[model samples]
Target: MTVTDTAPRALRTPRADRSNGQWKVDGRAALNGTEEFKAEDNGINVRERIETIYARDGFDSIPDSDLHGRFRWWGLYTQRKPGIDGGRTAQLEPHELEDRYFMMRIRSDGAALTPEALRVLGSISTDFARGTADITDRQNIQYHWIEIENVPEIWRRLESVGLETTTACGDTTRGFLGSPVAGVAADEIIDPTPVICEIKRRWLGNPELTNLPRKFKTAVTGHPSLDVVHEINDIALVGVVHPALGPGYDLWVGGSLSTTPRLSERIGVFVTQEQAPDVWHGVVRIFRDYGYRRLRNKARLKFLLADWGTERFREVLESEYLGYRLPDGPPPAPAVGPGDHVGVHPQKDGRYYVGAAPLVGRVGGATLAGLADLIEQVGADAARLTAFQKVVVLGVPEEGLEAFVDGLESLGLTARPSLFRRSTMACTGIEFCKLAIVDTKDSAVSVIADLERRLADLEPLLDRPIELNLNGCPNSCARIQTADIGLKGQIITVGSGSGTGSGGVQVPGFQVHLGGGLAGTGRDAGELGRTVRGLKVPATEVADYVERVVRRYAAERTPGQSFAQWVARADEEALQ
Candidate 1:
């Protein structure tokens, strides 16, 4: 594809150089405690210490500096102590709530996993993590109950399968989310797997970009479905076919969700496939140099984007970083279908890809091993994971399709799941997460089961999937604000403030957000859900609350109206 060729301009006063030689310092002082410590030592250096010291000496040997901060660079976090209820989540300190066990995240860029790799992951989970494995929204696999003693062995097993947890967490470039059906999708605009691979190869563990002000997320999708949730990523390249240039990518920057949620903006630039890697590198470097470091809350690239605005951001990215002006481009076409490629679908080849949901990404070790066996038995090419916490088995021959589907059913995975099963998503809540205020995985599963039975009659009236994203906290790990029904886990007071148990009570619950949706999911653009004032559904009554609202939606919505559309225009009384 063709692109604009603008000569590089000489640098005058570079914004990235504002920090000077001080790592986290502005002019005279360190930004925060994190900045002060991070300046003292490179986070990546902790690997040697882990391998030589902590692994041998055990959990207590780890210093708080490495335990709380540096360990995250390698995707390690101390898991929540067992038997700790949601009520005590915020009451206790981080050290008080943390157990000796750990939660390790394994990066799975491009969502591609071979049968052998699947087997290894299953083995790792079974042996090291007490059989805990959950597919994160970013396509990484998370394991709980990990120990410092087993981390080295876990790394060895993962590396043997061409996987590693480096930069999976912390203030680094996290795993790049790609379309699960990247190269295999029938209607793909351009296979983004190559770009993802190229960027990973060059920058995955590179020390140059190892330490950013905060975590930076990247999404690359060539599928027309926009499968990678591009609008919510820090840097995204959406597939587009220029009128004259044919197929390439449209640059999008500064999308993120958390306490401060912001939809990414298209930078109005077209980039050929060859230029993608360098462009990605430049943007990240810009963040590393110019991003906020003073306060942890304002450190995300989104805040910088807000300060600079899209036009100025693009100009700096071009002149200061890329050293070349990219061609102006059109926005991506509206998504043609559901981004989550659930159920059976045809691949580009004569073979097929069967997508299955596993109850909001909860796939245990034995099940993963079973999947590997099934893949081999069915002669499928590979198994892929989706952003929606589902798995897709690719290259299933037409002849073995029936057998593969049956095998998936036997494993509690469903290619043809109910709408609730297919759309509901949840984060790792109080069960394992230290930051969580309420249960999520179990909560989401419960909601899906309840809705499947309660709203079965309303299914015929629904035209599109109604997404329910359940998050453990305000962090939005499950993209709570981008679902038709977003439930943010919180502990709310149920009765008047007076006494214990019955008189006044702080109970595990959720604050509801309605009508949120992304462009890929049917809205023309991304929209955050609106919060209903003074509305809190107790954890025990979430199912009842959802059922009541949904039944009302089914009874009142106009013809051909999407759940988001109806929720947007519906009155608060109808929502309640």
Candidate 2:
């Protein structure tokens, strides 16, 4: 009923005892000693105890072949129900596995056609009989609802495409994320594509670093804008132009979002173009060594940074980087162009790149195939997908821009930038994810449609964008905290009074929160507003209330003012 702020418990370290030859003790008994004989015996006993526990819990590893049948092998799995079988809905299970999904990333080098890769994808689709492939936000392709029986065959097929599923999941480093418009953007400070490739080459499938305390994420931005939500990544290298170092980046470390969301702390070290890889490795090593593993919830790099303050974290990183001398790099210079890659823009080569809007980040199978065809026709100098759920078709010659734009229009995809659509995002919700409590995608679409209909009278209100984010659960995958209008699903009590023997109570529809924002230049988006009980007002009515608030307080704001600023300036009680 209420969003409670539960403080985390403090970490406790075991105390050491010096009474008996530098022995370790818990309470008052001898725990371990420096004696060689006792230490060997202790190690044997510990290993035996661990093996016993693993056996009792059935936590041993399962072969890749039996991944599907052994549903509980990984502690959790996914599958489909009979008759509910095709489409994305079949993938959604509240708390059970029907099938398993595996993902792989491949680099195509902007070539016209990779028949081998296409063959592999098609073969996997056939082998699984039910698996569907979708491209991810990070320019990687994911094959979902894969049957366990086809794991080996799928791997073989992927191998033909220069792809592998070995390090895609678990605690290993994921696919490196770079600006999709890497070399194609007109105003790029540096092309991060090669950088990402180098990082992946150095880290992927490395057994020595495969087992980590938690999964790690990293992003390199060629654009000044944090288009990849770089600040939320475990490691972020953002390109900035410094007068002294020419073009370089500032390294951000230990940032993540989950139940405990924290902004990354800057290390104050500017990485030169040549030293980025070395700096990245040093940060990962620090996290691997110092990250807490015993406490699963507190195992993230952010928690480690919290334990050791930013200064201390940097000191350890510096110690790690002692041998790898970096070139002299200076602070970033001011950005020259707009940060967003959403509209059509000219490339450095005098070509145009069209940013196509993919509503809700969903494109039909036919549409996806069509996009691939278009890319083939346009030449894949680069194709980028922004964090805002839009795709960019880069490096089309200026002469062909008109034709390419027409082709996009023919496909029902447009380059027109709408403030509402630009600022909206929703997770897959009930459509695919099991943890979703509400149909967030549908709800978001409906709310946006209604807002458009009601706000038709208020034209020229598109100067400033107002983010409206909806998440089905508190996981915040949609980044609800950075929105002007943030709506998180919550069950409210529909009826009051004692429950009758025959009568039943109604389930509450949704709980809405407003004005949560990320910290930076536009940091203050205020806190949660009032809990709008669904029983008294329908969900549709809630939309109307939001419209009224937007129209009242944000109708005639100053040039640079946002809806969030309006909310902050208004009297809290009146708004509530």
Best by lDDT: 1
How do the predictions measure up, each by TM-score?
0.94, 0.75
Model 2 spans with C-alpha error above 4 angstroms: 1-143, 151-166, 321-340, 378-380, 410-412, 495-513, 516-546, 573-576
Model 1, span 1-576: residue lDDT tens = 111111122112324544532232354256588887777877888999999999999999999999999999999999999888877887899999999999999988875799999999999889988888998888889999998998999899889988999988888999888888888888889999899989988888788898788999998999988888889999999999999988999999988888878888889999889999999998898888877776677788877787778899989889989899999987899888887788788999988988999999999889999999999998999988888888888899999999999999888898989988998999999899999989999988988898899999888778788888889899999988888988899888887763356587878889888888898776778887777776778899988988898888888888888887887777778887
Clashes of each: 0, 9
Evaluate model 2: give its lDDT: 0.55
Model 2 poorest ten-residue lDDT run: 20-29
Which whole-number lDDT from 0 to 100 does residue 330 have in model 1?
79
Q: What is the C-alpha lDDT of each candidate?
A: 0.86, 0.55
